[model samples]
Target: MVQAEPETAACMALRDELLGPLRKQTLSTEKLCEVGRLFCGAPERMSLYGVAAPHMEAGGVRVRGRTAVECTIDEYAGEAADAVALYAGNLREGSESDPLVVDLFCGSGNLGHHLGRRLGRRVHASELDPQVYETARDNLSRVGSGVEVEHTDYRHLIARLGARTENDVYVVEPPWGDAVGAVGLDLTRTTPPVADILADILRARAGKSCVVVTKTTTETVCDSLRNAFRGAAHLCSFAPSAPGAGVEFHIFRLGATDQP
Candidate 1:
């Protein structure tokens, strides 16, 4: 007597046929490590999976303005990971309704892939580096949304988002390449600051509610950002628990304003 939703039916079928089995089957890191060692003829191959293998495997050295520091695997930050988890939690309420999620500075597309698979929505990712962009494109393909990747900088993200008005939720991880005022004359040991990118997004679309996650630990930079963004900024530190995880990251929820 009751009409069933088309999306719901399709999702149930997908779960029964695909994901249910995957969930039941556990991936053994130890086995993967053994295989990696056997394939590479090096026992250390397994340890390489931490935060350096992907870039090393690509044979890419640091280039452009990103070379002053040593390169680490562009692994997804824990806060960004947490944000995705929370977003997934919200989706459990309604099976059929999936929000359009956009991820900027999507290095290797790991975060986007997780989001796309979990929420069953079209995922869009943008990256700056050609090498990294290709990597993201390849990684996202594993999740079923093909050719949805774009190679671009975060500065032009507003224009891209305008064209895709369907994208209501934004998951951004802009490049924290330099510390505040560290471009030309001023320089600091700060790894990556998330304020400039936040300001740009705020200036572009102040009315839209965006969930932004940034990874950085420069005190001066943090102070500057907190002073600049005011109530929208919140420090999300995971050090006490996840010791080897990452630096203290910032989470900002942009406030609604009449300005566009």
Candidate 2:
């Protein structure tokens, strides 16, 4: 009974029907090699379902100070940022102080900054990696992005801020190795597991409503996610059709909260 159930169901159905074939499709090693050469990461990340060098795929190289450092699929990241902003802004449970948009495993704050700006709301980003956290804090500060970059664990962040708030949105894109597989993404494999993360979130909310938009590959297995996060909504940017060019988004909504 969430805001966009019917639309989300259509997206999920398409992905489910096409997932098997997509998994069988050969994953080109060229992109993997290129990314691997450009950025050192886990071997699993070297796949078509892995991270890109800069995440600013098409436009240009420089990335406006947010360069190869941030690990995101630029195409989907933009779509998701826009989607999250729009989604959060329309939440029926909006509080006096606009609901917070939080990013989990936020790597340099590029996506978070964009989301904050697009949402026109307060945003908080958390990075476990010290180096990345420092970089995000400094860069966001210099640019005056107005996002609060925290060097803390996601669990703690959720427990602290995930109380039954009026409206809040979370963006999650965990690492490829544990989260994504060579053939498809696995929620159970994700570090700390996506289900575990969701459990914490649900527990914190205590039946309150919220949204979690997680970025996954086109090859992501629908069944895994269905079991891990039941009733979640799907947002297909270009994933099922274009595959490598874009990514998939699974939006997990806690309860019924109609949109404006």
Candidate 3:
């Protein structure tokens, strides 16, 4: 992944010159960044992924909520379907007495809700933020497929997961925060490096049949993920997919054949 263009104070000033910083900003960080990309040299029409936005504004950053979710859903609504297909395909290859789905950082139960309803599997999800956790609980509760959600850090959830069967599937889509560096989104910069989260999951599963459905971006850099998986993650998308839509998912099947 490339480092996004620095949206430092000076660069932000450039953006302010055109948009004016004094106003209550209505544009998302991405929209603002895309605009930044326009003035920062890249004039190509953008999906925010083809050409990394590479810029930022101080006042316009969003902490989190529906705005981010709406933008994300628009970009990556296909990933959930892809994940469901992946899990179905995995079941075709092997059998488990009881298979479970997990979401390490379930924001508002979107992934888990879809997986539970579509796959008819027990979905376990956790969210750190109290407000987000409430939203996740409410959504998943309506699924009626017994999706369990916890309001706690993912690390704590990992510790309580106990022993896993051979067919347990894990999904991770940590909070990416509001900043994207010059080149692109760095996996290491996530709340807690995604590699570490995956590694912990692998250890908990104990070298059994494991699969990770992870959220990614077009410009995501993965030196660390490669090292951890010891295998490449296959990029999957929704039907009628757009390459630079700014949303991506990587599926990694690592189990008995993995390296130390």
Candidate 4:
């Protein structure tokens, strides 16, 4: 008989607890953070085995209706994906000597954090939620000491970036309420649709080789952007093929025609 590894005890204990019929009825982003912190502190041996942990303490957990879900550090919509996609494509296309890139609605500064590391430049982020904004500030501070995070609505982010136009690269991950209110989203009345926000950013850019990325479930965002930018758009679309999920994920890219 093979001997059990030293970590087997803790790993099995964790597996049993996590696998037991989901008893965490009080779910919120704060609660998620607490759990994440606890889990992260578990013995390194346990963590290395199979008890997966978040990269950053979970900002929070989200609860809606009767179902509850945990929010990982990078779980926010287009948060990680947008930054990574842009870094590989448009963000890399421009040299570090170019203008700064702004990440509007920069929750936890994930997009900006990744952009700064990739391009070796500053990434300005705008966020509104006090808790989330603070979290982003801390994260970005470490990634790029030059990162500037403003705790304000994304609508005002452009003005701030416009003032710092040495190298203008814009990346955004607007909130589209998934089942979880991870982004402090008010799902009541969809006041400014994602498309409108994209249009607003496009206008505010004022002709710079900007790279804008957004996450959405409908083709409407692409259509709207195309109409507004006149066929100057690159769109990548993907849909989860799991059961009972009909919505798709769309990555829309609109580059600046003229570099200022």
- Provide the overall lDDT of each model, using Cα atoms, as 2-decimal numbers: 0.42, 0.55, 0.53, 0.44
RMSD versus native structure for model 3: 8.8
Q: Global lDDT for candidate 1?
A: 0.42
lDDT of 1 by residue, 1-260 (tens): 00012224443443333223432232244432332233222323322213232233343321111210111122333335555556423443234434446676665455555555555566666777776666446544543442267888766865546422222445555444333232211112222234455556656664554555444433344355465457573434332132232234455555552336
Candidate 2: tens digits of C-alpha lDDT, residues 3-78: 1112244434433332333322222344333333333332233221123433323212122112232355334456
In the range 1-260, model 4's lDDT, one tens digit per residue, is 00022324553454334334433333344433333334333222111111123322242322221111112122232233444454435444355545556777665454455556566666677777665566556645543344588989877878545633423556545544342222222222133555566567666666444555544332343244345335445555553332222233444445455444
What TM-score against the true fold does each predicted structure earn? 0.54, 0.65, 0.63, 0.53
lDDT of 3: 0.53
Candidate 2: minimum summed lDDT over ten consecutive residues — where?
58-67
Off by over 4 Å in 4: 1-97, 142-146, 163-168, 178-191, 207-209, 217-230, 235-256
Report the backbone clash tally of model 3.
10
Q: Supply the TM-score for candidate 1.
A: 0.54
Model 2 alpha-carbon miss at residue 27, Å: 26
Candidate 3 wrongly placed segments (more than 4 Å): 1-75, 87-96, 142-146, 222-225, 231-244, 257-260
Which 10 consecutive residues of model 4 have the lowest summed lDDT?
43-52
What TM-score quantifies how close candidate 2 is to the native fold? 0.65
* Top TM-score prediction, candidate number: 2
What are the RMSDs of all candidates, in order? 15.6, 11.0, 8.8, 10.7
Q: Give the TM-score of candidate 3.
A: 0.63
